[model samples]
Target: MKFYTFAKSVAYSILKPLYRIEAIGTENFPKEGGVLLCSNHINNFDPPVVGIMIPRTVYFMAKEELFAVPILGDIIRRCNAFPVKRGMSDRDALRKGLSVLKDGHILGIFPEGTRSKTGELGKGLAGVGFFALRSNAQVVPCAVIGPYKAFRKLKVVYGKPMQMDELRKAKASPEEVTDLIMAEIQKLITEYR
Candidate 1:
């Protein structure tokens, strides 16, 4: 009946067996309220994997190019993913994200905007951190351990919520918050990997 239910069903039906999945700490997710899902970006399908795996609707900021593909774009739109420019801040994207949190849904973000070609975790972009601060939402630090494929048994581990106050200090720049989130996420991913 809900949009998320349809999206989840379709995504699971289509993707679950497409890649082997090993997920943990999903219980760490709160039963209600606005929450930020901060995760490392390694594979192209990481967003969908994380989004569909959760029972709650998790809206993510999709890189604009993903929308350029016809069929994939349609699916993404149906899943409630909004477009975001990689290098520049897209105000419209931010507004959509802000509204999603205001609506009390999960906001999924790959702090590193791009997929890691080298498979090396890079620094995070500030969007997730700043958004959490603005929304006063709980930040759920998650990691998807490598190689989204059947044989690998891809791992997804979600740790406990990170303190929002970590980003609330007077001198905290967006970049610092970004690094903190990335480091925390990277640490989890490293261990999982």
Candidate 2:
């Protein structure tokens, strides 16, 4: 926790200037309490870019293979990263992430389930809606604009938190809820693109 606290501060300090960062709709974030930050993934660096950019410590669900790289894995683990089995439900990963939110910590998930290689936005997976309904934690939609191009800047745009009350009142079926979350994720990402 101490390491993340320090790293987060240093990271934001450097990145805010380096990347010309701007966080839109930041007020959507509840100043305190757990939050589920769902973002569109486009680059391998997206996690750290968002991680170091956000003011809070965001526990990211990274692939298990990343944790296999000896010392780098140890550093990532210390920075509050957990491994998810690639190309699967990764039930254990989801459970652990939910557990973090239950403890009032921010958790980051890429609902699209993979990176955007085509440079076109894709739909979200069902896991996002499932966890939101179960946790009742606020969801903060986010987007990343541009790539980590050589000598170019990238942007991380934050969207307003989805209204949990509205979601509850909608009395959406499972499919409806999933569709709704995906719609929001898409909206958040489109502006960035």
| TM-scores of the candidates in the order shown | 0.91, 0.86
In candidate 2, list every pair of residues with a backbone clash.
none
Model 1 lDDT tens row, 1-193: 2765777887787777777776788888888988889887888778878877777888888989989998988888777888998899789999888888888988898887888888788878878767877887788888888676665677788888787775586657778777877888888877878
**Best candidate, lDDT-wise?**
1
| Candidate 2 lDDT, 18-52, residue by residue in tens | 66665666656667678888888888867777777
Per-model CA lDDT versus the true structure: 0.81, 0.77
